[model samples]
Target: MKNLLDILSNPHKRMPLDTLMKCEVVLEKLDFKRSEGLPPSGAQGKEQIFNPLLEVVNKCLQSPLANHTLKRTFGSTLHALNGPEIKNLPPPAKIAKVEEPPMEIPDVLQGEIARLDSRFKVSLDTMQTLGSEGSISLFAELQSARLPCVPPLQVFVPRGYPAAPPAASVARAAHSKPDHFLKLLNKAMDHKCARLPKNCSVGQLLDAWEMSVRQACAPNATTANYAPVPALGI
Candidate 1:
C-alpha cells in the first residue's frame, strides 16, 4: 500500500521527463515482485516490498500530470488490487441572477386607496344627521299648507331600488301617494319649525329639511350650513 502522505508531499515539484520514464519502469517491475530476481517473501519481506512501492507512488505523485493521470490509472488498474477508487470530479457551477421590477407610484396610490376604504364607513358619519319624528312633522306641515309636495318623509329607510318608476323607493313613495304622504310631511315640518327661528319662512324650512335629508344619505356629501335668509329674497 502507498503512504498517502508521502504521495502528497513530493508531488512532482520539478522532475526531468527521462526520470519519469525510468520511475514507470521501476513501478512495473515491483508489481510482479521480480525486481533483480527478488522473489515474493514472508511478512517482513512483504513490508519491505510495500515500502519501495510506496516510494514509487510518492515519486509518481510529484509528476506534472500526477493528479489527473495517476487518478485515472488508479481507478482503472488498482481495482484488481482492491485500491480505493478516485472520486469523480464535479462540474463547475453556473450562477444566474434575477432582476426585480421597478418600484412604482401606482403601488403607493393603491395603498392609499385601501387605507381610505378601510376608514370610509366611519368617516361617513361626518356628513349625515339622524332622522327623528321631526322629519315626519315637516312632511305634515307642507301638506296642511296645500302645497304641491313630494313629502320628504323618506331618507331614513335603508336604500334600495324601486320595483317601479323613479329607480328609488323614496321617489316612488313621493309619486304614489300624495295625501297620506302630505300628512307625514306636515309632521316633519312642525318639528323643524319649533327648533328653527320663529321668522323662518316656509321656503327656508323646506331648504333646511332637504339639507338635513341629504346630509343623512351621504355622510360624505359636501354642502353649506343652512343660512337664515338669502339677500336676494330667497
Candidate 2:
C-alpha cells in the first residue's frame, strides 16, 4: 500500500506491466477485505473506507504522464468503491443562438419610399440583400375604381430601380380572377413603360403600376392576349 501510494504520487514515473498487474490485485484484495464484514448497506460506508485511496487514484487519473493501464486499473477500483453513485457526470454546455442584423434601406430611395407610403399607405414587409443586389417587398392598400374591396397590393422592388420598373401583383384572395388580373396589369405596365422616356423615376413607375392595376380591375375589364413578362428580380 505504501509502494502504491509512492507510485501514485509520482505519476511521471512509469510502472512496469507486472507492477501494474500486482497493484490491481492488491486493490481487489483490499475491496474484498473491506466488504467481508460490512452489512449489505449503501455505498456511504464503502466510500468512507476507500476515500483516501480514491483521492490518490483520482489525482493520478488526471495526470498526462500516467500509464494508460495504471489509469484503467485505478478507474475500476474507483467504480468498485463508489458503485453506481459515481456515475453522475457534468451536463453538456449549451450553445447560444445568433440573430441576423436588420436590413437597412438605401438613403437614395428613402424619400421615394416615404412619398409612396404617404400616398398609397405602403408598409415594408421584407428587405434582403446579396452582394451589391437587393430587393424590397411591401404591401400597399389600393382603392382602385370599380373594385369591390380594397385589395392589399404586393409590390416587388428589384435591385435596379428607376432604370428597371418594379413589378406589382394583387393578393390571391383579393381578386376573383387573380391570374387574369395579374396578366393584364403586367401587360399594361410593360406597354406604358415602353412608351415613356428612358430613366423614369421610381414614383413614375409606381404611378404607372397603380394605373395598370386600375385598368385591370375595371368593371368592364377583359383579359388581353399578351406575352408574359418576367417578374422583378431580387
Candidate 3:
C-alpha cells in the first residue's frame, strides 16, 4: 500500500509515460490482502486499512492518463472491499421540475384561420403555427370528386399574410409524378396572386389555387404549356 501510494505521489514534476506504465504494472501485481491482517471489527478495520489507499487510487483514477483496464481493476478492488456498505447506501433524491407556458397564435392569423374554417367547411385541426414570425402550415384535401388521384395540398402561409402569397405543393402520388404538376400549380398560383388586389384574403388565394388545379387537370387542358420548353437545337 505504501509503495502504491509512493508511485501515485511521484516527486517528479512530469513523470515519463514509460514510468507511469511501470507504476500501473506494479499496481496490477500488488495483492490487496483484506482478510489476513485486518482487525475483527468489520467496518472499522477495513476503513483504517483502506482509507488512504482508497483516496490515492481515486485521485489516480481521476487522471486523464488512467485507461479503462486500470479503472476496472480499481473499481473491482474497491467493490470487493466495501460491497455491503455501497449496497446499503440510500438512493439519491428526485428534483422538482417547472412546466413551461403554452404558445399562443397571433390574433390576425387566428382570425384568418377561423374565416378559412367557416368558408371552406374544413377542419383546421391540422394547421400548425410555426415560430414567433406568425407563419403557418396546413394540409388541405381537394373536395373535387373528379380528382380522386390528387393528394392533399400542403400550404404554407408566410409571416406577412394577405400581403405575402402562400405557397402550395402536393405530395408525390404512388401512381403519378406530381413534382412537375406541383411546379406548374404553384407558378400559376403565384401569377394569379400577383394580379389580385393588394388586400386579397387567404381564402381568395386558395380559391384561385383550386381553380388552377382544376384547369391543369382538365381532360382537354395540357400542363405542357406551363412546362418550360427545351433550348433550340444547335
lDDT of 2 at 94: 85
Best by the TM-score measure: 2
lDDT tens digits, residues 151-190, model 3? 5665666656656656555445677664766666655555
Candidate 2 on 1-234: residue-level lDDT in tens?
555766776656555566766877877766544544565557566456555665676666567855885655466555655685646678988888765556565565678877664456677774434332456676777554455344566766665665565665655563366566566766776666565555555566567667777777776766554455544332
TM-score of candidate 1 versus the correct structure, residues matched by position: 0.18
Q: Model 1, 1-234: lDDT tens per residue?
A: 333333334544444445544666655665443442554466455547566566565566578978785665444434645776688889878778755443222343234324532212111112333332111111212232223434333221122211111101122352465554333434343444446653443334345555344343443533233334322111
lDDT of 1 at 71: 62
Quality of model 2 by C-alpha lDDT: 0.62
Candidate 3's TM-score reads: 0.43
Off by over 4 Å in 2: 1-87, 126-134, 144-150, 160-165, 174-176, 179-186, 196-198, 214-234
Clashes of each: 22, 0, 0
Cα-based TM-score, every candidate: 0.18, 0.47, 0.43
Task: Give the total clashing residue pairs for model 2.
Answer: 0
- In candidate 2, how many Å is residue 163 off? 6.3
